[model samples]
Target: MAPPGCPAVAPVGKWKVIGHLQLLCLLALAQPGGPAWPCPALCQCFGNMTVFCSEEGLRNIPEEIPPSTTQLFFVETALASVPSRAFTNIAGSSHLTTLAFLGSSLEALGEAAFAGLPALRVLEISTSQLTALPGEALHGLTNLSTLSVKFSPIETLETGLFNSTPRLETLHLQGNEMESLPSDIFHPLRSLKTLTLSQNHLAELPGEVLAPLGSLQVLKLSDNNLTCLPPGFFLPLVQLQELFLDGNALMELPPGAFSRLTSLKGLHLQHNALRGLLPSVFAAQTNLTSLYLDNNRLTELPERLFHGTPSLSVLSVANNQLQALPARLFRKSPCLTLIVLSHNRLSRLPAGVFQGLPALTKLLLSHNNLTALPRDAFANLTSLEVLDLAHNQLATLPEGIFDSNIILFNVALKSNPWACDCHLAHMADWLQHTDALLNLQTLCRSPAYLKGLSLPTVKKEQLVCLPGPGSSRCRAEGLEPSGEPGTLPQCTYQDPVGAIHLACDPDACQQLSLHLPGQHFSENWTLGSGCGTVRVHITVHIEQDKAQPGGEAVLP
Candidate 1:
């Protein structure tokens, strides 16, 4: 028991002893060297080690951190700039592996700002207003492996900006305003494997700028303003596997431009101003698997353009001005699976144009000036599935154009000047019979007639027919149907079928012909006879097959 003025001390049990020990431990932790600090309302503590001051209205980094704190995250704050000596005090702590300022209002980074991070492996400061990067900003990040500064306003990067980070494996500077890179900007990154600089304004690249990246596997420079490429521009990237140059202003590629890139598997050069391709432009790249050359100004291709690339699976040359193609253009590429030649000026196709490609699956030849097609045009294309011949001048097609291709699915022949003649009789039959094939709104535009009429709806009787005996003819007296005269009696027929069908024996027909005015034989004339009389003689011969089975049948 204690005195009257003092508080009484109760008898201690196990629980009371434990409570006193915890109080002593808390008091020890509350010292200057402990984890306790003047944390803000949005901060939390984890036993003497780390502080998470996330989502706070902090304008800058806190002045002081607990001495034992090994990691700090000031995420989504109102930080505008990381001032000098910001992380100088944290050099004494060796356990900090990450320091992220993600989703903050950080606008700029001063010189030597990040020189204190020694063990930092990743620094993600994306979605910032960083217009320019200081040369020495990321100098001390020696062990950094990944750095992503995407979606920034970085217009220019000074030389030696990445001189210190040698072990960097992945660097993403995409969605920036970098128009050009210094010649030696990437000299120190010897171990880099993946580099993405796409979605920028880089018009041209110095030859030596990309010559040092020996171990690079993927290089994406798409969506830029590159007008042309220098010779041997990409000759140094030996290990590059995928190169994307799509959506650029590349008018032409110099010969042997991609000769040194032996390991390149996929090359995208789509959407450019390439007027044509030289025969040997892609001569050296034999290992290419996919090549995209769509949306160019290629008028035609040389016979041996794809002579060496046997592994090419896809070749898209759509939206060009190609009027014709050589017979053996695709003779060497047997592995070509897809070919798109739509939106061209091909009025006719030579025979055996696609004879060599056996594995082709999809063929697009729509929107051309083709007026007719040969019978065996698609003879060798056995594996074809989708054939597009829409929007052309195909007036007629020969029979069995799609005979060899049993697996044909879609045949688009719409918007063509299909002549509704006897030549299209089989097509009309197929349109009504073939249920598996697609017969789009094909109309006719030929024979100086049958225009503005649907092919499916036109009747068979309206189609043109060859001249025969039943066709209208005109002849004169003593003249045969061929306008030849004879000594024997002869009669001419005028507007033969326009009158009516008549049947008579040769002897009986001559009697009726003598009743005309110009004949010498006279007849018992009927009443109200005309003053003038003409006589005409006719002859006829019946075929042996026209006789009845038993004997000759009498004429009516």
Candidate 2:
């Protein structure tokens, strides 16, 4: 009376034993087009060679899975221990390739746990309780190319641990408690290309630890306790393209540290205690494009330091103690697009420093003690788009300094003691026409009359350059008040209602006055009339602003 493929059952107590068969029929009907292959009672077997057994109550690997399953996910379960025969019955007859056992209570993988997974290519065991990789945990997984065991408390990786995985290309052991690596730990990983050992307590490494990995392309050793790097440490990594050495305690690097890295493209040496670098350390990295040397104590660099690296496009030497830069330091680097030299103690920049950088786009030179600039300092930056000159000792900028660059759009002129005198006429004119936005307010520092006032709102005529009362430029401008009291440079003037006389004498301060009538308005016309009075009087005008602290006056 049972279904066609269902086995017959004997009757019990004169009643047919069809209860178990009914349960099987219900599960069969849940499958698509009726179950052709036996599916696990605790898992969902998809038709595309995949099996997922992540149920909370199911503590063991399903024995009855589709034999062709290639991808198996045992996620978010309470399976405490995966014994040696855990995957034997399910993966033995199948061609399993990718297996992920994530976020489970998996504490230990018994020896030979992966014995039957010969075709396994990727295995990930993250967010689990695995503390160690047993000797034969990956016994027969010869074809495994990627193994990631992250977010676990794995402390040490013993030697010969990965002897069975010869074809492994990627290994990630980040965020672990590894303090050291055995000398021959990675000896069998001949084909490994990427190895990340970040967030560890590695203080030093043996010279020959990485000598066997000739095919490695990327290596991350950041966030460690390394205070120094051994000589010839990177001599074997000829094919490496990216090297990260940030977040360490390295104080300096020996010469020829990167001499053999000809194909390197990106080098990160930021966030270290490096105080200096030899010019020859990076002389051989010809293909390197990006270099980060920020957040260090470097005080100086060789003049021709980056001359050999013609392919470099971006470089940052910010947040250092550099006081000066040699002239034409970046002359040979034509491909440079961005340069950051902010937060340094640089007081001056030699002329023609950026002459050969034809492709330069952005230059950040803010937060320094530069008081003046050379006339042609920015003459060669034709393609510069953004220039940050804020928070410096700059009181005046050279005229026509940014004339050559027409593509410039944004410039920072804030936090500087700009003198709003005649010297700034050309710059003010340029600022008025350019499309650059003054996101910050620029204030004047000199010419007592313009102090504390925004530079952009000051008029051109108000920028009149009046030399000090004792300066030679004042005498040249016919303002030398020499003779006594009223016997000074004589002048005569007349208006429709009255005549006026003026003199550039030492004591003329009390006798000089001019007025225009407004009903009852009057200006005391007190003059001795002793010096030569005018026959054909000429009219003169002067204006006074009482709001000025000293009641300043201007004559036209």
Give each model a TM-score. 0.69, 0.76
Q: What residue runs in model 1 are displaced by over 4 Å at the alpha carbon? A: 1-58, 61-77, 84-104, 112-122, 431-438, 446-556
lDDT of 2 by residue, 1-556 (tens): 2222222222226755554234333443454543456767677666636666667887877776676667777767888887984666763334888887777888888877887787899998877887777767777889999999877888777666798999999998887777788888889989999998888788898888999888999999988888999899999898998898988999999889998999888888988999988877788978787888999899998887897787777889999999999896887677777799999999999988878776778899999888898887778677888888888899998887887777876778878999876789887777776553473377878654456777777666455554345431111112323235455443322223442323233234212223334323223333333343322211222234323222212332
As a whole number from 0 to 100, the lDDT of residue 409 in candidate 2 is: 66
Clashes of each: 9, 3
lDDT of 1: 0.68
Cα deviation of 522, candidate 2, in Å: 13
lDDT assessment of candidate 2 = 0.73
